[model samples]
Target: MQNDAFMHVRKMFPDLSSHRHRDMKVSVATEIKWVVFYRATITTRDGNYQHTIGQRKTLSFKDAKIINLQYCMGVCTRQLPCQNSGYTDPRECSECRCPEGYGGTFCENMAESTIPDCGGELNATSTYQTLQMEGDFQAPSGSSCAWRITVSLEGGYRSFYRTLLGRSM
Candidate 1:
């Protein structure tokens, strides 16, 4: 990961010495599934002069996918509301950076799923509730369902539990 970090930085500053990473500070900002977000700060020296540079980038080693590598390196100045566990996407200021199961321009809707009639919003209450789903599990490669569960009770806590039972055909 450190090597990939230097390679990414070198893309912007080709003249930067590879050895300069000794003065670099790389930290994990967030991790979601297979994606890992990183924030790197480096201190550079030119004779008696010194300078510092920082960038926020993401890397997915399993598939070699890097998010926000070409954009959103700096702070976003746009004011946009992102809903349902979503934040402003640096790559596209007008869109929200949604979590794994959410999507939309502002993350106000459930993500599209391959399975028909499988995604929507649900409301939970104090009583026990159940959500059951049955689909063809043999070829479930790209099938998915996203549901947003919300509770309106104030000053109360909620707990959720899920169980999956599958058998080979």
Candidate 2:
């Protein structure tokens, strides 16, 4: 959104720029026009990934947060995804930290992604929160892409998650 934010993000991932452009248009309120644009990049930190959203398109200021998007459905850019990939354009991804029970780029690791959507409570001793994001990712320990996210909390952990759309494997 701001140049300083862009600079800060570019600092984390050198590949990100402050002037990348993408021709993105969305139907917001029944109007089809360029509404967002920008560039984005990701870096591996320890056992997780850290992404920087920047270079917001002046039109929408939400589409220009990624670069070389191989998947486009909500906000990933680039269409004709390679089967089960990034979110479609126009969708904004939130930011959140994954829990121990879940791991992966999108945090959609089944068995670990959710805690049994059937009132299956966890057995931790702290607080529990949800990440600010959603995705249909293929678990690194499983086969086939699963439509899940780093949702829910366990171990009674504290609130350290935000809904952010992202792609992971």
Candidate 3:
């Protein structure tokens, strides 16, 4: 039986490399009645292809005449997860290759960003003004948080300071 299966495979793909070829699964489809289905997995430079051959009548592996055969091709044959939006068509692996701006096993992750000077300072002042800054801030140690506004005196006098308590600043 092994020799017969090997002969069939050799006859189908005479040049199939031993290192590249994976395995052959030969099974009898009893529910189909009198039909034997065998699948051969062959690896190539692009991907893997499953060649399924269905033989009829004789139970002997050597005498079973090939009645139906089909080839299912591509990387998706391995059945990997490919629900992500950024993934393109299958290339040479189980999962489709990601585009330029996408990544991950299924290309579900967006690529890192590259922006210049994302943060800068914007300051304004008037003759008489109320300074207001409001946002979420992380503190180093102080139990109480305060907003401080300092004003320099007209001459060499000391500076004027005011503190507003609570979360707002």
Candidate 4:
């Protein structure tokens, strides 16, 4: 695997001088399905650093069936305006990929929830506060809930929230 990877990199960067193996991660999806992730940092003769990632999927070990051997170079930059803890979409460079609870082009609005009265804005004070939510135990599959918490920055003061405990039924 190392020799094959080196040869592949040499083909792409012909002037590759040095390379270092960074990390390898393995995830098991099922008894016969597995995913392997590889990361490496390479340097060329021109002193340019490149970060590379490779993903390999194995379907069966008995038959040695491997598929979707994908590789990517460089990091995805946040070129688009992603608001409210969102991030730029690597597949669509011009768009933002919002979080689970955020929507809109730039993730500025709250995402719609399947449960009624599930999401809303709440104000936070300097003192500790509690926000509790209860729902039917037998909710349908794919039901979702969300909330947006905000705090006013008056008098040059900042506020933060800490979760003491969280549980899902």
Q: Which candidate is the best by TM-score?
A: 1
- Cα lDDT tens digits for candidate 2, 117-145: 21122222223432121332222222221
**lDDT by residue for model 3 (1-169), tens:** 2112111112222111222223422111221111113333443343211112343444432122121111223434464554332333445445554433334677554433222211111122234333232333322222222211222325522211111112222
**Where in model 2 is the C-alpha error above 4 Å?**
1-65, 68-86, 89-123, 126-141, 144-169
Candidate 4 C-alpha lDDT tens digits along 1-169: 1111111111121111122212311111210111012233444453221212232463221112111112211235445666754556656667666534457888777666655654455555545554444432332445554544444444542212111111233
What would the TM-scores of all predictions be? 0.39, 0.16, 0.20, 0.37
Q: Could you report the Cα RMSD, in angstroms, for every candidate shown? A: 17.6, 19.2, 33.9, 19.5
Q: Rank the candidates by TM-score, best first.
A: 1, 4, 3, 2
Instruction: Please tell me which model should have the higher TM-score, number 1 or number 2.
Output: 1
Candidate 3 pairs with clashing backbones: 133-169
Error of 4 at 1 (Å): 45
Q: Quote model 1's TM-score.
A: 0.39
- What local distance difference test score does each model get? 0.39, 0.25, 0.28, 0.37
Q: Poorest 10 consecutive residues of model 4 by lDDT?
A: 26-35
Best by lDDT: 1
Clashing pairs in 4: none
